[model samples]
Target: MKQKWRNFMTVLVLKINKNRLHDEEFVRPVTDLLEDFKVVDYREVKNLDFDKVIICGTALKDNEYLDNLDKFSWLKNCKKPVLGICAGMHIIGKILGYDLIENKKIGVEDNKYYLHSFKIEGLDESLEVENFKGMLFHPEVLNKELIKDFVNLT
Candidate 1:
């Protein structure tokens, strides 16, 4: 019984914090998003060894990791599948030269990190796309101008 991600495993899970960033909180519920991969602290990005990457949204701020500044280059230069969620999305936004702005928290019943819905754009209509609409629970907002080149999977 071979695992789904065993064939050329390239998934890299970034351990992140729930508040004020930093890593060390890469939990199962979050890593479950990917079939297989290795979990590494956000600080050890220089040792990253994978063709694909997944960034989870955790409670984080800039000050926690602003000084470390080692993985940013690798993240920006890697030409592989990169999936950034919540805080991860903010990292991507910054890598892509966008400014993160505060938005009215569009949250669920009691979750400050879950938005009610998201309108996806910048997708190729030819591909079989699914789940392009749903709740987005994050406090950051990257202007449309910066995301024009990004693919929105909802």
Candidate 2:
């Protein structure tokens, strides 16, 4: 008998929500768009083997991940490229010494308005700190092609 190997790229998706309901709104879309992905809570991400990391966003009111910033300290020393989405952007911003501006928004409509709604203290349209990069907007919703291209490029 011979052992065979399958060539599939795996991308790690760090879930930022405390409530599972938000998965359909945030996590599931990214996982569905990718050919291969693994969704795990942010706290359990250390020592995992992944080609890249995508920090998934959460509901507008879900700030549970913010309470546990220590779990994300590993990101500072991580060599692999990391892409942070909405809520994930705040995590990256907080880890990078940026101030988090929390706002109270009711109801879910089109999120495109969020792009211009609030600003992270010192972040910009594109983030390139050391090896990590982040975008304030949701690429999966705004530009699905970029996500697909990223998978192919990486």
Candidate 3:
């Protein structure tokens, strides 16, 4: 018999929660998007050996996760492609030296909204997936300058 795929894909989910209180905020879409991928917690983050990594979204925006931020220093030097959603984006912003601001004044409403349209700047059209219009949760806000470190990709 011939083998088609020889490797397993594992994603190390860098959870920012201090306890299990915010398990729901962790990335679940990762499993839904890839059938052959494994998502693990941050138990061995410093000694990790994963192909892809996901910095999970959080429920708090007061920078509470900062208590555990030191563990994620690896992110600054990580070479793999990263996708930060909501608070995850905030973490990435924090890593990129963006000051955390109070987005709480924006109010709380995480309901999904239709994304009228999006324009991804650099990705090839052939690599495009169906663009999602509506966001399912209230996204955490970061400074406008956070885009500087990113390519046409963020």
Candidate 4:
């Protein structure tokens, strides 16, 4: 019997925190979900040629991780499939000229319990499969005036 060769999808995991890269609970689920795909840390290599890239939650404050933004900006030019979760979304917004504003009210300290409704505009109806109700832990928000080209997949 011959073993079948499965096309592997490479996903770039952007390093956010110095400690999180070591967290098994955080890393395990993602690798499990993409069973056939390989998860590679973006920080390990200089040049990347991947099928898709996912930007996980990382410290993306201005001047905090300013250097990382350049890499993401370059990724945008690649026009490959990219998924930015929380901080990832903010990075995309910033790259598109949008500024993130801190929302003082309705803020939650715990990372487990902040849920809000997001309206997806200018996206294909097929993409809007369900209303995304998930734990949102970001203090920054996207400025609509700046992100005009990218479709909002909320």
Candidate 5:
């Protein structure tokens, strides 16, 4: 009998947090689901060889990453697909011209995956920003299937 091999995709996890402890809360869960991945600070997005990029979220109140927007400048020219979660979505939104005001809601809202919206609530557990590219919610906690889909798609 022949064994079937699965295609594994390399993922780059960008950690956006002030405290390393947040890595356990945010980064670890995402990395746990990936077969091939590398975790890097949001301020150090350098490598361009990964198949996909996952900008992991920080704590709800952890907004230190907001102070250094220049670190994510590479995202503008990055050809590889990317996914942003929670605070990750905030980084992307700021990069895309969305103001980072107290009003976290910057884009349109939809059912289920909020799509472009920055926040999620009620039945909506995540946001699908233009394809499965970005999400405003944490799949590691809410929807594990979505993360699996992202791994497969990338």
Candidate 6:
């Protein structure tokens, strides 16, 4: 018997700053979760063509992190699924009419310490995982107003 090949592919958008890729502790977990998935740098691709593209880390302007959001505007119009993690979430929020601002905290905390929770809004049963908990370590966060536009999936 032969194993079947899965066509699903995933691209990870990593920010390059000072000619180096941003390092985040969650990277390993995220990559492990998507075993066998293809990972591509967002800067190398001329177009947003993929089954799914995950945006991660901060891409500040002129910092070699690809801060030019206009270059990837096609994302808003594409049907392809997107998963923004941490800073990636902030980028998505900023693109979708929400402001991303700085918070006061820094450093990582265990999931038990933070107890972060999110509420699902404007979504039907089709989008499951309504309410759940997850670990987050960012000084900035998505504006409350934009919460309605996104479904919280842990």
For candidate 1, what is the TM-score? Answer: 0.56
For 59-86, candidate 2 gives per-residue lDDT tens digits of 7666778789999998887787788887
- Please provide, for model 6 over 1-154, each residue's C-alpha lDDT reduced to its tens digit, 9 standing for 90 to 100: 3222232454444442233444343243344344345455555656455455555443333223335666456656656556554445444554565444444333344321111122112321112121211113321232221221222221
Each prediction's TM-score versus the true structure: 0.56, 0.81, 0.54, 0.52, 0.76, 0.52
Clash number by candidate, in order: 9, 0, 3, 0, 0, 0
TM-score of model 3 vs. true structure: 0.54
Runs in model 1 with CA error above 4 Å?
1-8, 18-26, 60-63, 66-70, 104-106, 109-154
lDDT of each: 0.45, 0.72, 0.43, 0.41, 0.68, 0.39
Task: List runs of model 3 lying over 4 Å from the truth.
Answer: 1-8, 61-63, 105-154
lDDT of 3 by residue, 27-114 (tens): 4533333334445454446555765555555554334666666656777787665655455555565566654444332233333211
Instruction: Select the stronger candidate by TM-score from 4 and 5.
Output: 5
Poorly placed runs, candidate 4 (over 4 Å): 1-8, 38-45, 59-63, 104-154
**Candidate 5 segments whose C-alpha is farther than 4 A from its true place:** 1-7, 103-132
Ten contiguous residues with the weakest lDDT in model 3: 125-134
Higher TM-score: candidate 2 or 5?
2
- Could you say which candidate leads in lDDT? 2
For TM-score, candidate 1 versus 5, the one ahead is: 5
Q: List the residue pairs that clash in candidate 1.
A: 18-59, 19-59, 20-61, 21-60, 21-61, 113-137, 114-137, 115-136, 115-137
Candidate order, lDDT descending: 2, 5, 1, 3, 4, 6
Can you write out model 4's per-residue Cα lDDT over 13-114, one digit (the tens) per residue?
554444554335334433434424445454554657666555544432223344566655575465655655454555555665555555322335433222
Write the residue-wise lDDT of candidate 1 on 26-122 in tens digits.
2444443345568776876666567566665554333344344455657766666665655565555556555555543344434234532221233
**How many times do residue backbones clash in model 6?**
0
Badly placed stretches (over 4 Å) of model 6 are 1-26, 58-66, 108-154
